[model samples]
Target chain A: MKVVALAGGVGGAKMADGLARVLPAEDLTIIVNTGDDFNHFGLRICPDLDTVCYTLAGLANSLTGWGRSEETWNALDSIRRLGGPDWFQLGDKDLGTHLERTRRLSQGEPLSKIVRDFSHSWGIAPLVLPMSDQPVETWVETQEMGWLPFQEYFVAQQCQPRVKKFAFKGVEQSLPAPGVLDALEQADCLVICPSNPWVSIAPILNVPGIKESCEGICVRVAVSPIVGGKAIKGPAAKMYEELGIAPSVLAVAESYRGLIDGLVIDAVDNSCRDELEAMGIHVLVTKTVMQDYIDRMNLAKETLEFCQKLMLYKGRQ
Target chain B: MKVVALAGGVGGAKMADGLARVLPAEDLTIIVNTGDDFNHFGLRICPDLDTVCYTLAGLANSLTGWGRSEETWNALDSIRRLGGPDWFQLGDKDLGTHLERTRRLSQGEPLSKIVRDFSHSWGIAPLVLPMSDQPVETWVETQEMGWLPFQEYFVAQQCQPRVKKFAFKGVEQSLPAPGVLDALEQADCLVICPSNPWVSIAPILNVPGIKESCEGICVRVAVSPIVGGKAIKGPAAKMYEELGIAPSVLAVAESYRGLIDGLVIDAVDNSCRDELEAMGIHVLVTKTVMQDYIDRMNLAKETLEFCQKLMLYKGRQ
Candidate 1:
């Protein structure tokens, strides 16, 4: 069965990794958010895409859930001492991606082509696509800074930007890249890979024509990033609470009401299953903590079975 | 006694180093060639300027006459693994300059300010300014590549191209940076360091208003990059031969004939004193080979004394 997953950084990468492990390489297509891409020291840093790419290539630092394992920071430290902004951490080995990507982009190569070529170089098999070809930066509308780039708000500010809301700059101008529509069109299922609802998935859905494409054919499903008012990683839980949401699965379901067919939450948050089901959304509760390879595969198996059974029930009816 | 020294790379850096040791920090201003600057791995690299800066900071590699003394190439090797072009040999420590300069430039800081900041950061007190504010890339019109950027032609292509001529792209648009004119105007003596006559000094002179600003000012002099029909360091002699020059001090002198007031040669090439004198140029013969600290200081003393003699002669006339 063909499957398309939209993802952001570490947490989404982990889920994407789970899907890649469970499904055939030909069946899985991952669409990464490129909103964090920015030129720093002339290097084009694509944080989310790199997280997914490295995770798939087994090059990611599993402990940190970002950058390459065994990476050095000699370059970064030297750069810092030279008085460049050291807020956003770039590992030395990981810097190769930014360097090559920046160079290629400066030479008129598109981000899509660079990512595809880089994925090929890294020996990643599954199809990986950027959400949009044009710039669609996720800007945080903070009370202090007024508007901060997603990384500056999320990373540099350490998510301390009392975020009132988010603004996806250039989203109106962005279009879903070529393979994204095709991937959704051909897929048996569209999975929003447990990424941040407002920032990650919203940016993907914000792309013009993408929502229509996802709504047309695919059995769209979402794995809830929130379980028991907690995120698996990153600032999602804090962001949800700061945005006046209770940081719960029900809040996530509300956030993605029209977009998803099934909502996958952890067994720990099983109490909210009926509440979500009451809202006419199919709910699947399982061990969603991807602590090990087995956890990923098991969760992937359960989700696939849930989608398969739901489709079968609909077919019979 | 303010001084402005025009320089290229290694040989220029050596002379600049000698002068830097002898002169007061604020008195000596070294204007280095940015013609050798190139974008590698998305970072702006100023090769000639970096060589001068590192040498003056006492951080220069003794063997290579360029780059940082204690250096590591782990980043370059890592970049190679990531399938990047590591051909230009970017060391970890040297990356500090590129990163800082790039960061500052991206923030709309001028190259002159960045160079001064970099010099101060590295504990080099004397001023070092790029020859121009705007980029004036040196392109070698080669028989093979037609025209290649200076670094590509020099480092990547290994200078294999049959030299036709040179082009200083964007030179017409370039302006001599802030301190350049003032340094030239206020100087008691001007020393043209033993950098490449064609590639280095030519680029400096090619800057708009720089040549006119320095002409007929104080005691303008140059040290020999060529002695016994050979360059002390780098491809000056080879480049001279390829460009159809005889690779002698006379050819070197002829290149700078209109721009300089006096010439300095080693005692070894003293036989050609009459030839240089025939051109109506004052010549100084000295032990120019800077084998150690004493040799460098002695050469600096000779250059200074030569400048004094030129001023005295001019007074007599």
Candidate 2:
């Protein structure tokens, strides 16, 4: 079955990794959020894209869940000594990706094409597309830094900024990246990876017709990042609370109610399934946390099964 | 006495290291060529400036005669696997300098200021100036890659390109960086380090008024890179030969005849010293090839002594 998975970094990459292993390369198309993409040291860096690529290539630093494995940080050290921006840790090897991508981008290659070339280099056979080819940066309007780029807010400021609101710069003029709307349109099932909804998946949804594509035909299911009032990984639950939303699996379902058809939560969040179903949403309770590679595969398999069941029920209607 | 040195990479860096060790930081200023500086993987890489900094900071790789000491290849290896431009040897730690330099330059910081910052970061108290603040790329019109950049010729093609001509792009609009003229005007002597005259030192002269500064007030002396008929390091001799110029010290002196007041040659080229002097150039016949630290310091000292004597003669005049 043709499956389209929406993702960001870290949590999304892990789930994408699981899906890539479980499904045939040709069947899986990963649509990554480009909001985290920013320029550092004059090199274009797509943190989410790189994390997804590295994880798939088995070159990711298992410890950090970001950057390359066996990475040495002499470059960051030198930048720190030079009093340059050392807040964001760009590993020497990891810097190569940004450098090459920036070079290619300067040469007039589109972001999607640049990503395809890098993915091919890393032996990633699955189609990985950015949510938007146009430059769209995630800006966190914070009390401390006023409005800081996502990375500066997240990595540099250690996420300490009291986020007032989030802004997607360039989203107004941005078009859903080539193949994004098509991927959603043609997919037998659409799965949202266990990534942050507001910061990660929101950016993708905001890309004009991308959300519109999922509204009618596709059996869209979101894997809850929040289980038992806590995020599986990252600051999703905290961000939800900061935005004044209840940090729960049901909250995750409520946010995606218009675009999505179903929600999959951890067995620990099985109690919230009734509340979600009461809102006319299909709910599935599974072990949502992917602790290991096998767990990821199992979760992905279960997600696909849930989506297939949801689609079958929709066909009967 | 205040001294200014024209330097390139490796050999020149070694000499600069010795000179910096002997002379107090304030007494020495190194004017490095920027013709070899190019954007690699979108990072502005200044090879000559880096070599000088690494050598001065005692962070130079002893085995390679360049790059950072105790460097890791993880970044390079990953870059290669990612199909990055791996022909140019950029150590993991060394990448930081390029990244920050490019970052600063793109942010509207001048090359001179970036060099000063890098020098300061490495604890190099001596002034290190790029030949010019403007971008001057050395384009080698060659048999292989016609009009390839300097690094493309030297590193990528391994200097195998049959020379047609050397062109420095943007030389006309460029000005010698700040403090460069100050160093030249105030210095007691100037020693042209044993660098390629045509490629390395010529770019500095191409900067408007820089050559004129070296011409009038400074007691300009040159250490010949061409020993007998070959260079101590690099393809200077080969390049000279390919460019239809003889690879002798006399030919080298002839190249810089109008610029130099005196030429320092090896003991083996003592017979040719008279011929060089006959061409209206004062010649110092000494062992100009620096085999070790002692040799580098000794030659620097000898060059200073010759410049001191020339200044005394100037006083008499």
Candidate 3:
């Protein structure tokens, strides 16, 4: 089945990798969030896009779930010694991507085109598209810091500030990248990978035409980022708590309420099944914690199977 | 005695390092050529200034005569793998300097200020300064190509193209960086290091007020880069030959005919001493090929003594 996936960073990359392993090259397309993209050391750095690309190519550091494997920090060390900004950890091999991407971008090449070339270089088969070719900076409205760029709030500040709101700065004017809408329009299934709802998938959905196109898909499913009342990674749970919502699978479902037809929750959150069903959302409570490659593949298989079942039941209705 | 040295890259850095070892921090300032500075991968790279600083700080790669010791090439290797411009080798540690310098420059910090800070961070005692804070890009007009940026000719093209002419694009409008003229005006002696005279030392002389300031110094001397009719390193000899001048000590003396009182030539080119003397220029023939630290120090000492003798003779006159 042709599938389109929306992804953020580590958790999203893991799920996308699982999908790529299960589906044929032409059967899967990953639309990555570009809102977290920022310039560091004067080089354009797209955190989520690089994470997704590195995961798909098997070049990602499994330990960190980001950056490249066998990475060297000589550059970062030198920068630190020079008293330059050392807040952002840019690995030596990872810096190669930023240098080339920035070089190409400055020369007027689109972000999508550079990503496409990078995908080809990494021997990736599945098409990976950025959410938009234009810039969409993610800003966080915090109680302590007021308004800060997403990276400063996330990496630099370590997400200490209480979350008040999230803003995708240029989302109002951004169009879906070249192949994004086409993939959504033609897909049999649309999967929102287990990523942060506020900062990750929300930015992708905010891009014009993407959410509407996704709604036209036969089966739209969202895998909950929060499992067992905590986020698998990142500050999703803390953000939820700071925003005055108890972090749970139900909160995840409610966040994507009108966009998804079904919710895939972890077996630990099975108690929410009845509540979710009452709210007119199909519930799939399965083993959703992807700790290893096999776990990822198994969860991906179950999720695709659930989508197929939803498609069959919808056809009967 | 206060001294100011003009330098370019590897050869110049070696002489500057020798002088730094001999003189106290307050006694010497080295003015480095910035004509070859260019934006590569969107980062400002000052080759000569970096070479001089690295050499003096004991961080330079001894084998290559440039870059940092024990440098890692992971970034450049990855860039090559991605089919980006790999002609200029940027060691991971070297990239940190470029990145930080670019960041500070974009933030309105003068190149001189950044170099001063870098020198301090590197534990370099003597002052190191660029020729100008303003952009002074060296462009080479060649037989094969009309005109190419200095790095494109030197690093990318490997300096194979026949040299026709050299142009410092912004030199006419550029001012000497802070402290350059002050250092020259206060100097008891000025030593032009054995760098490419055409592209290296010439760019410094071309900067407004620098040449005049050097002329006011009590003693001024230059070490010949050409030894036995060939440049020690780089395309100096090739440029001289292409420009219709035989590369020799006499040619070197004539090149600095009016500006210098003495010329330091390698022992192999001592045959031209009489000719240089005939032209009213004092000649100091010595073992000027610096193979190691000892050689560099010896040459530096000999050059300084020669300058002192000239100064005493001028005082007598």
Best by TM-score: 3
Per-prediction DockQ scores?
0.47, 0.73, 0.84
How does chain A of every candidate compare to the true chain A by TM-score? Answer: 0.97, 0.97, 0.99
Residue B200 of model 3 has an lDDT of 98
TM-score head-to-head 1 vs 3, winner: 3
DockQ of prediction 3: 0.84
Model 3, A1-317: lDDT tens digits are: 89999999999999999999998999999999999999998899999999999999999999999999999999899889889999999999999999999999999999999999999999899999999999999999999999999999999999999999999999999999999999998999999999999999999999999989998999999999999999999999999999999999899988998888999999999999999998889989899888899988988999999999999999999
Distance from true position, residue A295, model 1, in Å?
Answer: 3.4
lDDT of 3 by residue, B1-317 (tens): 88899999999999999998888889999999999999999999999999999999999999989999999999898888788999998999999999999999999999999999999999999989999999998999999988999999999999999999999998999999998888998999999999999999999999989999999999999999999999989999999999999999888888898999999999898788888999999989999898899999999999999998999999999
Error of 2 at A241 (Å): 1.7
Model 1 alpha-carbon drift over 4 Å, by segment: A216-218, B39-43, B70-86, B143-147, B258-262, B267-287, B291-295, B309-317
How many clashing residue pairs, candidate 2? 0
User: Judged by DockQ relative to the true structure, which candidate is superior, 1 or 3?
Assistant: 3
Clashes (N, CA, C under 3 Å) per candidate: 0, 0, 0
Which residue pairs collide in model 1, if any?
A: none
- Model 2 lDDT per residue over A68-134, tens place: 8987788899888889888788887887777678877898889998888888988898899999889
Strongest candidate by lDDT: 3
Task: Give candidate 2 misplaced runs (Cα > 4 Å).
Answer: A143-145, B143-146, B312-317
- Estimated TM-score for each candidate: 0.91, 0.95, 0.99
